[model samples]
Target: MKIAFVSYEYPPDNAIGGIATYVQQAAHLLAQRGHTVEVFTASPTRTGCEAFPGLKVHRIQPLNRTSFPQEILATFAQRHHVVNFDVIEGPDCGAEGREIRQQFPDLPFVLKLHTPSYMLAAISHIPMTRLAQARFFLGSLRRGKWPQSSPAYHYRADPEYQHALHADVLSGPSQAILHQVQTDWQLNPANFINVPLPYIPPAISLDIPLDTSTQRVTFIGRLEIRKGILDLMRAIPLVLQQYPAAKFRFVGPAWPSPQANLNMQEYLSQKLRRYAASLEFVGAVPLDRIPEYLAQTDICVFPSIWENFPLVCLESMAAGRGVVGSHAGGMAEMLDGGNAGLLIPPKQPKPLAEALLQLLQDPDRRQQLGGIARERVLTEYSLENIGQRQEASYQAAITRHQLKFTNSPSIHA
Candidate 1:
């Protein structure tokens, strides 16, 4: 099958988040299985074509003010005469799906739902000051118009909801994400598929021995309140109350705005000054070093307020570390309802700290949970298994597309 992936973030050029990693991994795995894979992406700085053994990447430079979906369609139209694809898969959280379906009416297009703006707003609990709230409400009042100048334009004028309405197939990394999108969009459940993220564990030995006596807790994600960074910071002091030797590490890049990194650094310096000796902020570690870091740690904590199957939880599990994740979002499904690892409520420090303390004080329980976590990844969330599942979804989408063509009712008005 000739498959084309339409994502702005592909490897070697831009791998910003979990979606890029998933797309790259899926493309490679499918190529390894003797399928032809092509990626159509946008690169502001550079534009050209690159090739691998079984895969090819085409990068385009769009005009500054032009919409991304329109640019993608124009690029595809110019290239489709030479190379045809059986299926084109792109993220649904944008206007791309609606545009592509409109431009190429007969083309088979599948839109995978990652995190939509509406879903984010629905799950978000971060408080805002009156000034900020006033700004957001005023921006939203514009309605259907994407004012590039407004700070909240992305959240307010998000076109993913419209895209989903026209998508041939709606897929998500987990059932939780799928259900939430379906309920919110009022879509047919039969149109959705539960496709778990594909994970490839690091090749290096993760069997390094660790100090079991001292509790080493790690958190990896954007340093934002929505990621439960504030909650994690608050919980650290509580954990330290019981185990003074407990070490905490906060990893990953900053988010929300350009100055977020500076702001987070300031917060750490001022608020967490007393615990500076025990806390370390290793900002934005490379993806390759993540497994090595997790291998040395005893437990991983992801207390995100909202998520659609985060990559860190699965990576931590694959690294043979017990995870203390939030009870909300897809964490419950990932952790198997506290069976694989400990689960805690989001935006609260008390229960989160308690859960961390419980796992930290008991090495036997941590070891047991870590073992189960690793086994779950191996048995279910592996790259090989997920690749096969994705392939099945593509096939099923093709079948559905053909059936739609054949079963269309006559429309003679």
Candidate 2:
């Protein structure tokens, strides 16, 4: 099958977060399986097609600095006229594929679910400032809609949500995120499907021997309220009180907190000042350096308020490090209901501290959990296993597209 992926984020260039990682891994895996995979991605500086063995990347530059999506649509249309892709897939985060779907209504367009902007706003507890609330109320009045009636007014306004509503097929990496979007959008159960993301284990061995005596806790992700970074910082003090020798490392770019009027690093510095020597803030390292940090880690903690499927957890598990993940989102499932790693409630510093302390005290338990997590990643989240599932999902989407548009004009024409 000839597959085309449209994503704003793609690795080694416009890589931002999990979406880039997912697209790169999935596209490469599909290509390796004998599928002609073409990726349309953004490039701030360069623009052209880069051909790999089985994959082709079309790096698109924004036209007049105004129409990135329009440029994508035009380029895709020209390519489709020649290559005639079997399926086109893209993330539901920014509706990057929305224009493509509009152009080729009969083509199988899969809206892969990532956390939408509205959901991110909610997760971060973005306060409705007085001016913002006033604008919303005024806008509702102008549109002749009651503000109170539309609790999800933001969802309705979001292009990502609208794209999900009309896509040929919707697929997500986690049941938790799928369920949330299904309920929120009032989507038909048959239209939504769960497909886990693919993660290729690092080439170098992640089997570093666990240092039991000293606890090296590492958190890898943007430091934000949504990621429960504040909760993790609070828990650090508690953990340090019990086990003073334990060291905490935060490896990621720092995000500013609107609620606190300070960046996370600043907040951490001010709050956890007493334990300054114990904490390490390694901000914004390259993708290749992550495995190095993971190798040095003993216990990895991800206490996010909510997440889709986090790649960080998968990396930690793959490195044979015991992970303490929050139960508020897909981490619970990723941890296999606490079998592979420790699970804790989100937004609660007490439980997080307790969980961290539990692993810190018991070296055998950490080793045991890490071994189980490694095995789980090898078996479940592997490239081979996830690639097969992705293929099946794409085939299913094509079938569904054909059935739905049986009487419609052929997109090939």
Candidate 3:
């Protein structure tokens, strides 16, 4: 099958987060499986096509600072005229594929679920801009309700919501996120499917001995409220009180805290000043260096308030590090319901600290969990498994598109 992927983010150029990683790995996997995979992505400085053995990347540059998604639609149309792609997929975050779907209604378009902007804003505690707030206030007065009321009105206006509503099919990495979006958007259950992300395991051997001389607890990802970083900072003092020798490492870029009116790093430093000697803030390392950090870690903790399917957790699990993730989202399923890793409640410092202490004290249990985690990733979330699932989803989308257009009187006319 000839497949086309439309994303604003792709690796080595505009890569930002998990979406880039997912696209890179998935595209390569499909290409390796004899499918003609073409990736339509954005680049700030360069615009051209790069051809690999089985994959082609069409890097698009915006014209006169125009909308990126609109540029993507134009590029996709030019390529489709010649290549005639079998299926085209893109993320729902920016609704990058919405314009393409509108222009090419007969072509199957898969809206891959990433955390949408509205959800991210709420999760990160980001307040609306003054203009938006004023608009909301006026809208509330017209509806005769408080500014805080009418969430549905806000959702309806979101481009991501509208795009999801119109996609040929929707696919997500976790059922947790899929269910939430389906309910919020009032979507058909049959239109959405769950397909876990593909992960390429670290090239290093899994049997490498863990460095257990000093108990090291690592928290990766952006330092913000959504990541439950504040609660982790609160829990650090408790863990230090019991085990003073244990060390903590935060590996990510620092974000400002609106609530504290200061950068998160500064806030955390002032709050946990006494435990400064034990903490290390390794800010924003490149993607290649993560395995080296995980190699030294005895325990990995991700206490996010909500997540779809975090790749960091999977990376930690692949490295044979015992993971402690929050139960508020998909981590519970990723950890096999606490059998492979410990699950704790999100935003609760006490529970997070307790779980850390448990793993710190027990070397045997940590090793056991780590071993199980490695096996789980190898078997369940492998490239072969995920590639097959992705292909199946595309086929389903094509069939759905065909049926919808086939029964339409306008198409017949």
Q: Which ten residues in a row have the lowest lDDT in candidate 2?
A: 404-413
Better structure of 2 and 3 per TM-score? 3
lDDT per residue for candidate 3 within 1-413, as digits (tens), equals 99999988898888788999999999999999999999999888899999999999999787632377888877889999999998999898888887888898778888999887777877877555577779989998899977673254467788888887667778999988888887777778788889999898867736546445448999999988899998898899899999988999999988986444668887788888888999999999898889888887899999999998999999999888989999987888899999999999998999999999999999889989989998999999988888899999999988888888667311110
Cα RMSD of all models vs. native, in order, equals 4.9, 4.5, 4.3
TM-score of each: 0.87, 0.91, 0.91
Evaluate all candidate structures by whole-model CA lDDT and list the values in order.
0.77, 0.85, 0.86
Model 3 clash pairs are: none
Cα lDDT over the full model 3: 0.86
Error in Å for residue 198 of model 2: 0.3
Q: How many Å off is the CA of 329 in candidate 2? A: 1.2
lDDT for 299 (candidate 1): 88
Q: Which 10 residues in a row give candidate 1 its minimum summed lDDT? A: 147-156
Could you give candidate 2's per-residue lDDT for residues 236-260 as a string of tens digits? 9899999999999999988976445
| Best-matching candidate per lDDT | 3
lDDT of 1 by residue, 1-413 (tens): 88888887776667777777888888888888899898887777788888887898888776641366677777777667667778888886555546667877677767887888666665444455567767767786678554343244342245676566556677788888888777766678888888888877665524534334446898887777778888887888999999898999888775443233356656765678999999888888778888777866888999988788898898888777878999778889888899899999888999999999998888888888888887888888876788888888888777777777779522111
Candidate 3 Cα outliers beyond 4 Å, as residue runs: 63-66, 126-153, 205-207, 259-261, 408-413
Q: Name model 1 segments beyond 4 Å from true.
A: 63-66, 122-126, 129-158, 205-214, 256-262, 409-413
Better of 1 and 3 by TM-score: 3
